[model samples]
Target: MSTTTETLKSQWEALKAENPHMRIRNAAEKLGVSEAELVATSIGEGVTRLRPEFAAILTEVEKLSKVMALTRNDECVHERKGVYLNPDFSSPHAGLFVGEDIDLRIFLSAWDKAYAVVEKGEDRDKKSLQFFGKDGLAIHKIYTTRDSNDAAFDVIVEQFKSDNQSNEETTVAVPLDIDEKPDSEIDVDGFKAAWIDLKDTHEFFGMLRKFGVTRTQALRLAPSEEHAHKIEKDAIVKMLEGAAAQKLPIMCFVGNRGNIQIHTGLVRKTMWHNNWFNVMDPDFNLHLDMDKIAQTWIVRKPTEDGVVTAIEVFNEMGEIIVQFFGKRKPGIPELTEWRELVASL
Candidate 1:
């Protein structure tokens, strides 16, 4: 090991000894390094580096049977327990795992580093496959549950293990500075027309791109009050509580730069832990830091079936923390109860 790596490893060990319960992500932030770098320090210990063949590795994930799929941004964490099925990698830039319980939208281009990790647990070893973005932050993670196929997990580890097992520090990319165009320059009339004429929710991104306006900016400049309007951030909590109380099946989406994990079902238990609001359900869990939310918008988009409504939450950085929509697929109109619930907010 190089002098620098040895120094980092020593520092990491000292930190862990001092704060054994600290998560590696927090430890990395404290040590002024990437989480991937900290995990790399244990390359030959409990961590095995995996090749960047993310799509292929994901294709083999189904063999492990039931696992927990986790995706998070800075403000929210989404976890869903399900089988990895229906692997689709036809697109070079992206992929999808369209299972009923665990649904994911994967962006292959953002995937950079991967590792197969095992940690000693109370009863047995905890196993997981973690993938990271170019920024050295985790994009997605799959953890083996008690019912998971341990033998299949071992097979996958051996199959895609990287030839290089060096504990090299991960490279962190410089944060991108994407400045949104001034709203004054946008064609308000044209943008509103396009938004009104939208047929699918998926076309929303294209409309934003066409107008060169950011998500929050578009919300602020919504042509009509019915189209979009700001609401109190606390509405998120109320929404969850209302959904749980009414047994309303809702869709919650949380994602970062690389992946978006969706949970389309009922949210049963809702509670608060410190500043974080949580949805503690059997098959799905969501931890959202309420303090990070800066703005909440009730956005309505026109669709062929009817108008679709969504509760979109954003952080101070103008990044989406989480989005809630009525559990409905294409060709279906928005649920009246959901629309009423959002309108009540």
Candidate 2:
């Protein structure tokens, strides 16, 4: 068979390999359900029937197919084994999202990697929701409507592993800086000036700390907390300088209304294995657990800032972990559907 044909076969086997006794969502933390479709698929293929309400699945599944293609072979080190999937999902319905890629090690010990995608648009006669996996495997599911958390399609991959049959994965994050922060390696006034001016790349993270902002708390900002708890200059600078020391990769993203997200990169070694801070194989891929890394980034701060903010950090990945963003002003950048579609990891 040709490469594409072989690839399809591999994916089909992978999908079929999933235990029918288990739900479509492998992780208990999975945010959505497939019980209805799961029943449809288990009913011996063609014999399976779809409820009138199930028409939604077809449209969304189509969108999901398109989205999965976007994530193929993208670069992301923080991504856990199961494609760096969620450790504890809060969304009521499960949908594969293509935002910032995560480090699976931060959440689970033995990460099970899988490709994630989701369906989009609404039209039963038009499109359907589709999900795919790593081996170019595609499984189409129908969905009439989606909850806010729906974004992509995904699967738990640990059961296929010889050693990971019974164990669960937990996500953990690693800090970038190895050296302790000196009280002196901080400056909030400078950061404050940066926030107000919005010109020149001024770092305001230091001041955030003065307002009692901390690396520990920075990662917990909610989806709607665009401007959550504004902090003083000193606090912001301290957090920036301190986080930069670890050389952590910032975890920001573009969200609703073209918002730019600015958050700390507590999950170190997520980009390239920091030769200065990590150990790796001959390929130099950091051997650290990715599940742990993702938990570190997510648990640390909620995604803040606007779309421009995430792109800025995306290009700058080094000792200096800086973040400065604003709302959608004319010249300022905002989040975009394409940016999320192109995310790495």
Candidate 3:
């Protein structure tokens, strides 16, 4: 129970290989175990083994990477272009898509419980899980359930306290900027949508706090804005927290239109992205490991035109973490060019 999957399986396999003629029961005895246990353990080990599909996919991705060599000579990594800032406040690994509301009693609730499990395994430090979905989605979650009187929940709750989850104090209710008004003249819904779009996703609620967008403006801004507005972020979170109890339409940004819409039929889903983020507090563990932590990118073309290579991280659990869309970081003048383009936009 406290051994590596490889170590346990190796023992089992050695016994089986040494005596291929022995009966299954005899093989179990050779491994100093019961036949049922041996059989179940083998099956479990097989499940954890990377699937053939995954192995082949990895091989193919590696092969595709060779194309990076046949390109122009602008290989210098620049400041803005080469900088890969780690956004640790964002959830690690895996992107999930949420179709509808889900019962949180199991996977979602259980995950909040399981995180406290003793770090009983190897250094998953180099490993980042890639969940395939947006920031807030979670699919195929196996959760622990509890009723009103379920005493087990107490034990789980205690574990959280024993762990570091509760050790740190958090504060909310940020001081509003002078520019932030008590109210605005925009239509409540339309303005909210507009505000949400104009806000930044990776930054704190800067647009709302700094730009003085009203709730309606924030909401409107989110759908079409380049970033998230405070109200929009808060609204999305409220839907996620109560998802286990009731299903609600998780608002998704529909292209360039600033319209908000909801999807349904969520059951143990896991497709979400961590869009809103910020760094704060006495200690900055929030930003500890910011970039390229077990992330992957999909291989686009070997090379694209004048651009030699480009890459971005993906959170698909089994898919490659980062994919090169254009040129690799470190450019001659693209950084300045990009800054000017963004500013112009």
Candidate 4:
């Protein structure tokens, strides 16, 4: 190893000795390096750098039955439990994982480094495959569960192990700034007209790109109060409570720039502690920073089946923190009870 890397490794070891419970991401920040770089330091010990064949890795992931898929941003963490099935990787820049239990939207272009992590510590022995973006931010992670196929995981890890095992210092790229148009510059009438004529909920992203307007701007330009309206930030807690009371299965989407993790089921437990609104269930947990929620909107979109409504929460920077929707299939319409619950909010 180079002098600089050797010094970094010593520093990291010292930091770990100081606080063994520190997460790797936090440790990387404390050491002024990326998480990928820190994990690379343990290449031969418990980490194996994987070749950047994300699609192939995902295909192998399907064989490791009953794994937990985790995706997160700075403010929210989403975890789902299921097998990675029905993966569609035909697109060069994007991929889709359409499974009944584990649903994901993968942006292939942003995916950069990958590693298979195996940590046998005093307390626990954990195994996982972690993927990172160009900026060294985590895109997605797949962890082995009690019911997972450990043999399959071991085989895939060996299959994709990189030839290069050097632990060299690396630099992370700066994230690009989004060029969002101002609300005033958007054609309010035209945007509203197009929104009203929307055929499917999936077209919402296309509509935003076509008008060159951000999501918050579009919500502000909604034609009528019925179409879009701001709600109290605490409404999220109420919505969750109501859903649980009604036994309503809902879909929650939390994503970063590279991947979106979804949870579709009835949330049975809700807790608020330290300004975090959380769904603490046995298999799924959603931790959302309530203080980061700067705005909440009830948005309505016209679909072939009927008008679909959603509760979208945004942070101060106009980035979506989390979205909630009533669980319904494509051919079926939104639940009347869910619509009533949204209206009550």
lDDT of 3 at 244: 27
On a 0 to 100 scale, what is the lDDT of residue 225 in model 4? Answer: 89
Model 4 Cα lDDT, one tens digit per residue, 260-298: 888888999899888888888877889898877899999
Q: Distance (Å) between predicted and true CA of 124, model 1?
A: 1.3
Q: How accurate locally, in lDDT, is each candidate? A: 0.91, 0.27, 0.25, 0.87
What digit string (tens of lDDT, one per residue) describes model 3 on residues 1-345? 335434656776776678766654456556654333443343322212121122122122221111111000011110000111111212233212222221111112211111111111263211111111111111111112111122332343342232222211111222322343444543446544433343222222354455556323343343432232122223222333343234322221111011111112221232333532222211110111123233322111111222221122222222112111111133331223322222222
Highest TM-score against the true fold, candidate: 1
* Predicted structure with the largest lDDT when compared to the true one: 1
**TM-scores of the candidates in the order shown:** 0.97, 0.22, 0.18, 0.94
Clashing pairs in 4: none
lDDT of 2 by residue, 128-173 (tens): 2323322212222222232212334321111111232211212233
Go through the candidates in order and give the C-alpha RMSD of each one to the true structure.
1.2, 19.2, 22.6, 1.8
Q: How far off is model 4, as Cα RMSD?
A: 1.8
Q: What is the lDDT for 288 in model 2?
A: 25
lDDT, residue 317, candidate 3: 25
> What is the C-alpha lDDT profile of model 1 across 15-109, one tens digit per residue?
98999998788898999988888888888889999999999999999999999999998899999999999989998766898878989899988
Count clashes in each candidate, considering only residues at least 3 apart in sequence or on different chains.
0, 107, 79, 0
